[model samples]
Target: MATSAATPHNKIIGQRELVVIVALLMSLNALAIDAMLPALGQMAAELNVQDGNRRQLVVAVYLLANGLGCLLPGSLADRFGRRPVLFVSLAAYAACSLLIAAIHSFEVLLALRGIQGVLCAGLMVVPTAIIRDQYEGDKMARLMSLVSAVFITVPVIAPSLGQGVLLFAGWRWIFILFAVVAAVTGLWVWLRLPETLHPENRQRVELPVVLRNMRTGLLNRGAIGYVLGAGLLVGAVFGYVNSAQQLLGEHFGVGEWFPLVFGGTAAMMAVSNIVNSRIVERFGARRVSHAGVLTFIVVSAAQVWAAHYRPGELAVFLPLMATNLMLLGFLGANFGSIAMQPFARIAGAASSVQTFCRMFGAAVVGLLIGQAYDGSARPFAHALLMCSVSALVLVLFSEKGRLFRRLNPPRQQQPAGPPPV
Candidate 1:
């Protein structure tokens, strides 16, 4: 397929430019979450946070806010436009970051962090809706894969960046750094990104209409299954992220090198993302995603068993951790594509609802697992086992109780190629 002719405002910005823009916007969530990892301990100390385990709440609250944020913006973008919603959300995110920087008490910090998470939800939902507005099938997968590849780097570098700021300035500067990045990104979007949703395609924002669309989306058997499955997958990842610093630093005594170790694991995820991008076109998104989910379950189960017997060995843990992270690369992109496939006509509303389910569902699961933290790797392993089993069950239900059967059966495979953007 030839590229579409550029719009007047997009004369200099081709598909590549649009992909980068969407990727950057989507990456805000990752950067916010990952960047805070190194600063978690320091923030706890500075805010005089009483409970050692409660520090994880700083991260969990933000994710919970993000889940809540996804619901309203989808309808808003459908009514107003993607550009306006995005601009407003980014600006709000910047303001929240600044407020977070100024907070002294842990309770206030938690509230502000939740606000930031909610603001960040717009960044995640709108970009995919925008992409659906312009492209579909393999092209959408390619663009998303490319974006995932780029977005994965945020985790790779974010902890290192946070650690550097903490070492030099203070924990407060982490929020300052987030503010600066959000402002720059907001300005870029305000100037460069065009409104993809035309007036005719825009849906009315009446409460009744929004509710009908959301209800319709949820009622679709395929949509519900994929959304819940994706949520469970994300819950697994969040569970790991919430405890990673503690596992690496306190348990393993990596201490100062914790960020580097975490970053390296993140880099492996990026590598798997690249691999997924390459293979998705040839094998098809459904086949690849289903296989990946099964693989993840097996790997997670192995980790649980190993932890039970060899709780003290890094050798027993590190490889499984890397494998689990790598599997997420596969799950993240394909699950989104699969869930959206059935709802492309009402992409905005569908994206919003599915995103809300995934983020909020994950937040709830992650928070529950986090509260069970017992100052050891037990919480992490148990969480993974629970998530993997739950996700596998959801996957089965999503496929109409067909466990391990193909979601989309493979036809003759397409030639392995770069995804269309």
Candidate 2:
């Protein structure tokens, strides 16, 4: 509900418009990954890829690059401005997409995907910085929940969008579409979005300065611990993403109906975000996310049991996978806010570090789990179960052995992080 008081007269923009733009910006990465799920088969075929599991690199590589890519943007955003950084990054993304479309070698294709992901870092880091610039505390949490609600739609539909594109055009055109969309978004950003980084707050974009700020952000145990903990929780979802196509289409026999099945599972994440947005103010983020993590552990245990003793058909697989992903919504919406909450001064750099840890860690975890795929759900289920257990351990450490307590809560000015349960 906050408004831009700096805007002239009747043209003031507020939370609603900010929510839409931020959500769209955040959606770029989700769309980039999800839309490619349906095309993994065709991409493997066209490129002469021999192994089905290796094809997962098409998703994993991009994500890995995206995480490592965050290192520079946060420092840059803090110094130059969010707008220019976004513009240049989007332009680079478009160019990389075009370059990727023409590349024939698998190695070269992966190289370009890495570069594209690096460019996509702007879209990922800047908007969260923008949100932090505008709001704080529980208000920030509530607004993020709303942004996530809208952003989740991208995953719910991206596979279908990619499938429709695949129906007529080849897989290469998918990258071409990436080029086109980035160009349009770049223009929109250039024209409408104002610079969120205030002049007085701008720091010099130098290596020493950047490192010092990054070190400051890293020193906060509350932030650092939560970043590592949440990464493990979300990493389980990334593992599923790495194998979604093979698991749903080939192993379970969903075939052309793959998008619908994928989207249905993803829709739960969106619904959870909406529900979180509704009740986060009343119940506090720590309490709800803790419950979600507990639920995730239970589901993960059931999945491991089912996969080991007797792997079920698609009917059994769908609900278990879908429910686990849904739990991620509670973690995602709150965890980011938690990590960024205490370091408002270095929001951009802090955001980058926290996000980098989560993504890089999750990418490694997902890559391992994906490589372990044996045309069965055992690897994925086992990975999730282990991750959920690890997540609990992390949650304890992050909160100093807390489980459900919300010490001081977020609405009131209180301690740095959650209290012990």
Per-candidate TM-scores read 0.92, 0.93
Question: So what's the TM-score on candidate 1?
Answer: 0.92
lDDT of each: 0.78, 0.80
Residues 54-169 of candidate 2: C-alpha lDDT, one tens digit per residue? 89998999988998888788878876777778887788888988898898888888888888888778788888888987777667788999999999999899999999999899
Q: What C-alpha lDDT does candidate 2 achieve relative to the native structure?
A: 0.80
Which 10 residues in a row give candidate 1 its minimum summed lDDT?
412-421
* Cα shift from native, residue 398, model 2 (Å): 1.9
Clashing pairs in 2: 402-421
Q: Write the per-residue lDDT of candidate 1 for residues 1-421, one digit (tens) a residue.
A: 1222332254345687788889899888888889989888888888887786789998889889999889888878876778788888888888998888887899998888887888778898999988877766555676788788888899889999999987789888888888899899987877777777655556777777777777765656665777888788788778778877787788767889988889888888788878887888777776777788888888888888877788867777888888988988887887787667655546777789889999999988888777776766777787787787777777667777764333442221211122112
